[model samples]
Target: MMDSLEGEELCYPLLLNVSCRGLMRPRFEAILLYTLFSSITVLTVALNLMVIISISHFRQLHTPTNLLLLSLAVSDLLVGVVVMPVETVRFIETCWLLGDVMCALSYIIGFTLTSASVGNMVLISIDRFVAICYPLQYPNKITRSRIEVSVCLCWACSFLYNGLILKDHLRQPDRYNSCYGECMVVINYISGTVDLVFTFIGPCSIILILYIRVFIVAVSQARAMQSHITAAAARKVPVTAKKSERKAARTLGIVILVFLMSFCPYYYPSLAGQDISNDASSWAIVSWLLFFNSCLNPIIYAFFYPWFRKAIRFIVTLKILEQGSSQANIL
Candidate 1:
């Protein structure tokens, strides 16, 4: 009985000498953390799932930009479905119980999804810039086929890029673990900094620049429309089109701003090329913050869209399951 009790304290009982210790916190504290993380994981999956259903089920929700959003939702859904739960298990147990292959696969999947989401956001910003600044060319430049191709490229690049990031670890999954029952993949500060710049900072800067131009164009168009209301009825089509562009610009701008705010702190270490060691005391809390921010995304993104709201109503009322529901005029 004593041996069994002692073995429970270590992640691997038989290999006690080299095994990492489990979370030794008070039982209440451990339970609390587990419950909280579980809630976040479930909420993330539920919210992103709704987004995926809303976009995919509604024919009217299909657009170049919504397609990009659908891509993001898919990635974020996987983060919740695959990444968050894996992370939660790792965090609560404070041990890598799933073995070496899972450890490597989890990080690769997480990074790829995150990187792909950023890529989709960049594409969204470009789409808005063209739609608002050069309305005449929007349709030709941001066609359905082109957007589909871009999304495919974004995901493909993400998978390829993340694989390269962890190539060494992939080759030898146990390479960095200091002992049995431990799971770790190390990225030297230089490689991490390079990743930070390429995957995060560079993309954010591009998104900001594009959105700024979009905002300027949108504002000027708004003013011009305000001054020409006398003939608004005569030029209703162009005016409506411009108004829709402005609304999309404004709403997506807010979404991008929120994204920047929540994710900025997570990447702040990149500026100093700081190492992200799991052994750091702040790892649990800091990592937990990321999931908290994720839940806010569906709230902010969906709040701005009437079409999304309509789709939610359908989904909630179970009308979405009705035959021919996809033909509903959601817009």
Candidate 2:
């Protein structure tokens, strides 16, 4: 008979000597938590799928900005489809059932998606900065082809950079395992510090700087509009220009804010000069916090962007399946 401590059990009872222990929770609590997390995984996949289909299928929505959004949705969708399920299992079971190869692959996918997200955010910040601060030059500078190339470069760089960062773990997935049923990876201080600068601090700095400039320009334009309102009222002038810029600024600002919130907690250990360990209980919470951002992104779009709402309506009603639907004027 297998020995048990209280209600706890070994992950691999037959190989008890090499097995890692699993946390035992009450049956009701385990069921409830599983249901909750499964629901989030489903919702995240569905929301990002809507974004992907809306952007890809609709010809009218195929702008440079929307392309960038499509890229983001792809990363977010992978988070739901690939990362979240595995992570859910990891957190809930508290032991690794999958073999060593899978362990390394999971982390690679997670890091790649994360890096891609940051890259997409940076591209979006630049897009908005140019649109709001230099409206006239935006048309000439931000072309569809250029944006496509940039998105490809962003993804390619993310794959390359993360591969380099996790190269050793990929080479030896079982190196950090304490027993047969454990999955973990350790980054040395030097490697961790380098990753911190490139992946976290550097990209965040660029995003913040660009958005600040955008914000300043947006404020100045708002004030100018206020000043002109009285004078322009006599001439029946249109505030369309000011309204568009302000709206774009507001939407992107919310995106940046949410991104920061999702990412900061995950990196807190690094910022505090602590080694990131997957075995820590706090790791589960922080990892899920980061993953939850994917779910919130489509919610943000649904709330802020009218086109997304219209697209969702069409998608839900199956209007998108009709012939020549791509030409439908969603904008």
Which candidate has the highest TM-score of all? 2
Across residues 201-269, which tens digit of lDDT does each residue of candidate 2 receive? 888899888988887787677667766677647344346655656675776678768878888887777
Q: For residues 212-275, write the lDDT of model 1, one tens digit per residue.
A: 7877777777667666666647466576767767675777677667767656766666666786
TM-score, each model? 0.87, 0.91
**Candidate 2, residue 95: lDDT:** 69
Which candidate achieves the best lDDT against the true structure? Answer: 2
Tally clashing residue pairs in candidate 2. 0
Taking all chains together, the TM-score of candidate 2 against the true structure is 0.91
lDDT of 1 at 113: 82
Each model's lDDT: 0.79, 0.84
Question: Global lDDT for candidate 2?
Answer: 0.84
C-alpha RMSD of each candidate structure in angstroms = 4.4, 3.0
